[model samples]
Target chain A: MVDDGGLDVVAPIGGAVRDLLRAAPGASVDLGAIDPRSTPGLPDEQLTGAERKGWARRQVELVGRDLARQQEMLFAGAKVDPDAGRRVLLVLQAMDCGGKDGTIKRVVGAMNPLGVHIRAFGPPTAEELRHHFLWRIRRALPPPGQLGVFNRSHYEDVLVPRVQERAPEHVWRPRYAEIDDFERELTAAGVVVVKVFLHISKVEQARRLLARLDDPTRHWKYHPSDVDARARWDDYQAAYADLLGRCGTDVAPWHVVPADRKWYRDWAVAHLLRETFDTLDLGYPPADFDIGRERERLLGTAGPLKVNRS
Target chain B: MVDDGGLDVVAPIGGAVRDLLRAAPGASVDLGAIDPRSTPGLPDEQLTGAERKGWARRQVELVGRDLARQQEMLFAGAKVDPDAGRRVLLVLQAMDCGGKDGTIKRVVGAMNPLGVHIRAFGPPTAEELRHHFLWRIRRALPPPGQLGVFNRSHYEDVLVPRVQERAPEHVWRPRYAEIDDFERELTAAGVVVVKVFLHISKVEQARRLLARLDDPTRHWKYHPSDVDARARWDDYQAAYADLLGRCGTDVAPWHVVPADRKWYRDWAVAHLLRETFDTLDLGYPPADFDIGRERERLLGTAGPLKVNRS
Candidate 1:
């Protein structure tokens, strides 16, 4: 029922949703100020859990279908106009167990894999460490006509080093400028950058970790370092706040999505993606060849038509 | 010095060199038929080890310079003629302790990192396993104008599965044809596929592994699985032979580079790359803007320009 208007009305609504979720640039972030459990994008009305779930699911499906259609046009446009140089890169940054993977699955997984490229950054390999932090990230960048998603991205270079004291202040402090320059260049090169920071409460993370441990199927996902990371939760939050304030430029602003509620987080991300695609205003390229003549020629071919009946 | 003629003479010589090093497609590759220790591309005259090393080094330097220049032209061509869709993808496959890394360093490392993209495949991640083997490989492909190097590649999907019995015959056997189709599509899409198999002797691999074990600093490179892999050397060789014979199409052929001698392997790879670039027949793109006028304008403007001495 929620899919009636589909992405027509949803696009503008999604813009409003993004404005509500966006973490203002240069503003000092107080994790306490944002309620992670709140679903600001959803209708402000009383509803049962099942109803809310159904509503979110329907919204996601509608948004996902619209997003898929936009992506197809984007890809088609790229193929026809190779020099047009249009692309999208969605960068997702979150704390340990903060739903980066979930966001990728719920938001990006809905699109065609052919048009979507996902690069999940873990600890740098020996070879990756040999180059600048941005080197590997640059290599993983999606070319024109593709939607590139960075599960954990170049933002980690700033956050991890600052939070873990891995690098000296002089070394890591300069990175904010470096990142700004990198994103600027990316935008100039026709990459539209959309950065989202999935904001999850510390309590939610602990609960997720405990759930992982409780379920045998999910045990492989649990890491001891996650607990260690949890110990420095406040430090990580501070680092994230600083990152949000510094790296959030006009070209690539950071959106702090409330992620404690999985359904809301999924819905919010889908909405954001739909809004981003709408701004691109992409359309399928005109047929390069005579389709009517080709169809007649195909029909005139001397061959027995084989039809599959299953 | 071997750099006397530089790239001008070396470019043509490199073509001759490739012919000498190329493994004849459809030939039953007896690993014994090829001498891994031989430097086929170098001079036949006897020389001291130091002299030989110097000669090889100079040759690599010349070829590397030429390759870099060609890559610059290739990148420029892409910028000017986006639809030209010209690109090169070098797939390097080798046994354990083979000179894949060394070859990449000596050959590709000499070029501009911006123009050279390297994707070193390790064991597939959980996400990678969810899709087709070529899924990740396809994503890492070079866009027009760039040279992409796959340290290990989709060939592994065939070799590893066959050697270790990781998959049923029904599963892995069809991959040869699958690979053929994949490569044909790549070639059609303007990607020049250069597949190189670094042919190393079992003795050479053991020696390299032992050397790794002997060095305290190199312990990270050693693995118990290396020994396990070495134990199945004959099986891997058979797999390699089959792959070479089957997938070596007119569009994408396989070159078996004798890789027991690190110096020879490096020089040969550099030569192969130089030849590949030469075949592209690339030239620097013409300046689109009025450079002469811009130069005059700069000279006419602003008095007493400050120059930094740092």
Candidate 2:
């Protein structure tokens, strides 16, 4: 019964609309179900299914290239100004077989290291576990003007322990509230987080595993025991579903990408990034004062870098 | 004079041979030119420039994926093995517009983040300047099984300020001894150090700069004042030439890559990384013990993890 207005292109789940609005203000968006009034600012073309995925891959490459280019420029100016530090925190997360690495390289491979700071989190050290679950992640945040991506994030506190039943029920369950609060603070501090769950079917993951084992170059990737984690698939999926249902928020939303399509995943990330950067009110630094005027002012003043003893 | 041998498609440099020898006790090595013999054990095709880069990038991707894989796997057999900690510290330094980032992305992009740590140094912060030049750098040394790339490194102490007269005469001059000693300590501490200087011509940089300006996305990479530094091209080149003359050592030699051809630069880094990893006797982990034997030991002991005792 909703108004079918512009060029419609989203599914009825409301994720794409939520993602766009969360990424950029005043971004009027519609997905496949509605016929929108205009498709001017739509991230992807109105194509659906396979065609849309093809377009998405090319679009992701463009967005990633654009992101790298912008980050490099802003960083070069860091010696002069620090304002370029406000880009969004793009966090990529998924289960054991999720394709975060290939996705990151394909999407942001060309970024200048000097511009974008990448931090990958591992399991808790003795000290890390002693503190709140979010402690380690908070410390690794990208300083201003950088796109910081957390490979596995604070969500682990809620996600894994719940599925594994490693922690007491009450302790792990309450963490969802804590996470929401922490994200709000990050947003308040100018960190916009885009959390993505790359949803790949178990069958696809099995195929990838087989490929890794068959290829010599990929032999390094086959950790003989990844099969054990695969056994817990149902438990993990239920946990992630609970996570997406509860933690999806207006400030920082979860994008449950149907990652069966790698091209579509790349396109979704690119679309998300463009929206994030387009919203930031960022530009070139202000000009330096006129050298002649500064010289005249220096002559008018008795004070100098070296103060007189008198 | 070094003996002349027919050049091979790929050959070992002196630094690599030394590290290989260091890894295996009593292993003999020759450093004069590419040693005459090729290892028949290594599959001939296993030694391509693309394969080398593919391996390292694959390792990094494996590490990143492992970290993001699942909580249990990250901790299952984790911790930087103390023995492997004596690995190399490979530093890549280049001219302002040279392709250091490209070198890393193409070479080690596949390696796991767990095995590599990267830091790019520009000007020192006020707090950093309070200590010795190497003070900040020492803290960034890579742990075991890791590769570290420094975009512009402490060599700048000699390369830049020395040319620009940014420091006093005695202060800048003696740092040559100071730097040599600092690296000697790293090598002595069991860290293999291979340093490179990607030498790009002024004309090449100008072309890249123009390219950056012409593309709207790339425009973010432009800053007007970088032009001021580019104007000092001749002096900086002289400074670099002098630096190479003084600092090139048997332990940590410099590879001056002619970067006009971008693919050639990529190939060089790929070759260098493969050479580095090939040196390590990265033997597989000790065999997993029989679960039945370990189970009895665990049952006989104080049992599963003790929470605590007052």
Candidate 3:
């Protein structure tokens, strides 16, 4: 077990801890070795299942408040800072029924909707497919002072095509390098990229799928092809492992979150988000106007009301 | 003055009153005949300056709240309705210092930022000029459930090019028809277009320009070319007149707001916005999930938590 200080820690995830979470660049990733049930950085694992859920719930609430505050500061800073081009892009990648929607609602849903934008990528439309893969993604990037969340990002281009044998190795292999360069350019342009891979065991996914089947209201979300995708689980895992190894860079590292427990998954993602914001060291920008004069003017208790007439 | 049925009124701006405010399609617009000081629907206008200001302020506050509520409904309706393709595009066209920014801050700013989007168009970049003039405009259009405010929109294509002779008459003349078709298409696609022409006297503009020059803080907003634009005021007015006459269709009419008084302008715009939302007849969509069962599951007081194993 990795020593992660404690669950209540509220500092930037840096150095060894960040490195441990990241799939090392250019190194082989063993998906089987990393247990989906493991909750890294969580203390006292001896606690009962119910106790662990309660603890994670408390952590999520605390982290949610912190994340909201930091987001407000980021927005306030952009108002007055001339060089306030900094923004965040949180890319979520996962297998079918791996809880991407749940993660979005519990994690990013905590931030002010005004400052957060969520873009879910489904199959490309005819117009979208006409453009290069990156074109649509570039257009959907968050403007300054906003957090952009991509439910399934450009990574899907490589994943789906490779697994389904739609493209030969020659076509999709170079895309790993392309993705790294794209992420590097984004970081250079002041967009911090946080990519999360929600790791769920095949058994856990089947459980979630069955739950969806049990709930009549969630029937709209069910797809027949999900079973076919499940049949190719090993192929998908191989594609993911290759991606995590090859595309993971020092600038835009990937965090593999153990997502078997919904509460723990929410807590971990929220904690990482708060840590990212804290690392940004954001503050409110300086006031541009004469605050005293403007205050008096608005209150109508100052000098002559300045009105221009011919 | 037209009776607005008090400040609390929430009906569509209709009949002869709306006709009085609109620049009729295909009819020559007499810019001189339309008084800049006229406040159409405001009651008891014959009062002291302070009293009129107070009354307008109260009306703006009330109308602003109503507009906010309507915007909320529009956003809510989108959540449950699969075919909720409703959106709004407020296209603001005016001379420099005609109060587009102020109107945006006071009117749309009162609505939830999540539902409202503002795009201020400056001179086109090289990339933008490469495409058709409408390309960038189309991309920036608000998606469903959004209220998009375009400060100085595609109308600039007709006005600037014609007055400066940047393009020959043949080039800009065809654009009027293009604009009419574009707006008609938007209306067909469920985008309610509210076009406003802020009418300010040249003398009033000069006064405002001088004020910008006098204030050190507002120096960045000032431009010497603004004076040059003012010198060609009659040419701009002619171009604007042509636009109002030619492009004002029954589907997308133009409101010629007399904007010499800032408070009255805000009130009128806010009132019109509230009326637009009311005409839309938006309501919250029905819940799509089983609220009671989901509540029980979340509370952890119901059926056994389902889990699957391979």
Candidate 3 chain B worst ten-residue window by lDDT: B294-303
Between 2 and 3, whose lDDT is larger?
3
Which stretches in model 1 have alpha-carbon errors above 4 Å?
Answer: A1-15, A46-50, A296-310, B1-310
Candidate 3: tens digits of C-alpha lDDT, residues A1-310: 2223465543322333344567777754788888888777665445565566676677687787788768767766654453757888999999988888778766765666656766778888899989888888998898778788888999998898899998798888888888999999999988999998999987777667666656654544555567677778899999999899888888998888888878878877887777688789976554455545443332332224346441
For model 3 chain A, the run of ten residues with the poorest summed lDDT:
A294-303
Q: List the lowest-lDDT window of 10 residues for candidate 2 chain A.
A: A29-38
TM-score of chain A of each: 0.92, 0.75, 0.90
DockQ of each: 0.01, 0.06, 0.06
lDDT accuracy of residue B287 in candidate 3: 41
For model 3, the chain A TM-score is 0.90
For model 1, what is the alpha-carbon lDDT of residue A18? 70
Candidate 3 regions with alpha-carbon error over 4 angstroms: A1-135, A142-181, A192-310, B1-20, B45-48, B51-62, B76-84, B124-135, B215-217, B287-310
Clashing pairs in 1: none
Instruction: Tell me the lDDT of model 3 at B270.
Output: 83
**lDDT, candidate 2, at B70:** 27
What is the DockQ (computed on Cα atoms) for candidate 2? 0.06
Model 1 chain B weakest 10-residue run by lDDT = B301-310
